[model samples]
Target: MTQYWYNVRTHQVEEDAMSDWTQLIGPYPTREEAEQALEKVKERNKSWDPNDTDGDGWADHD
Candidate 1:
């Protein structure tokens, strides 16, 4: 299957790991998902962060 990556440096979706790994977001299955890499990251961070809420990188963990 073809995997997609989001290039943080250029803010573009790539078909593969054409650039440095540090500058990439992920191996998302679709281009649309890759395009929302930053949003996905934020959402995921909020889910994982013990103090994340309201997408402010901090939440009321109570």
Candidate 2:
């Protein structure tokens, strides 16, 4: 099976893990998921942002 990644720097989806780690978003199972990387990230951030406001708890804090 092939792996997919989202290139953070270029906003492109790739089939291989060829970019730097800091510039990539995932090893998603499908190309479609990788293509919607920004949306995925935004969704995740939205879920986490509220918790971060308290500056406590799990302390993931961004």
Candidate 3:
């Protein structure tokens, strides 16, 4: 079975195992929706750093 993964922080979509654990920012079925959701998350969290020294490279809300 194929699964989809979406990053609430970056709104990046992919086919991976972690998709199940990821928070569904929206019921979005399209890439644009996911992108919009990611933007919303970014806007809500101003301190989020998309580029960090961490290996994950995920933006964190401080």
Candidate 4:
């Protein structure tokens, strides 16, 4: 299947890794998801925030 990538340097969604890997975000399943890459990153960063003092990207204690 074809893949999509989010180009960080150009802030564009590409059909594939047209640029360097260091400048790309993903092999997202769809263009829509690739387009929203930054938002997804923001959400993830929030989840992993150091000050979270909670889950912080770690497994939760049951």
Q: List the candidates' TM-scores in order.
A: 0.73, 0.73, 0.34, 0.76
- The CA-based lDDT of model 4 is what? 0.83
Ranking by TM-score: 4, 1, 2, 3
The sequence of per-residue lDDT tens digits that candidate 2 reaches over residues 1-62 is 89999998988888888888899988999999999888777666666666645443233544
lDDT of 1 by residue, 1-62 (tens): 99999998999999978999999989999999999998878777787887665666556676
Model 3 error, position 57 (Å): 17
RMSD of every candidate to native, in Å, equals 3.9, 5.3, 8.1, 6.5
- The backbone clash count of each candidate, in order, is 3, 0, 0, 0
Q: Considering lDDT, which of the candidate structures 2 and 4 is the better prediction for this target?
A: 4
Instruction: Estimate every model's Cα lDDT from 0 to 1.
Output: 0.87, 0.80, 0.53, 0.83
- Candidate 4 segments exceeding 4 Å error: 51-62
Collision pairs in model 3: none
Candidate 3 residues 1-62, lDDT tens each?
A: 54444665555765543555545555456655555665555555544554543524345447
Give lDDT tens digits, candidate 4, residues 1-62: 88999999999999868899999999999999999998887678667666544634433444
Between the candidate structures 2 and 3, which one is better when assessed by TM-score? 2
Q: Which stretches of candidate 2 lie above 4 Å from their native place?
A: 51-62
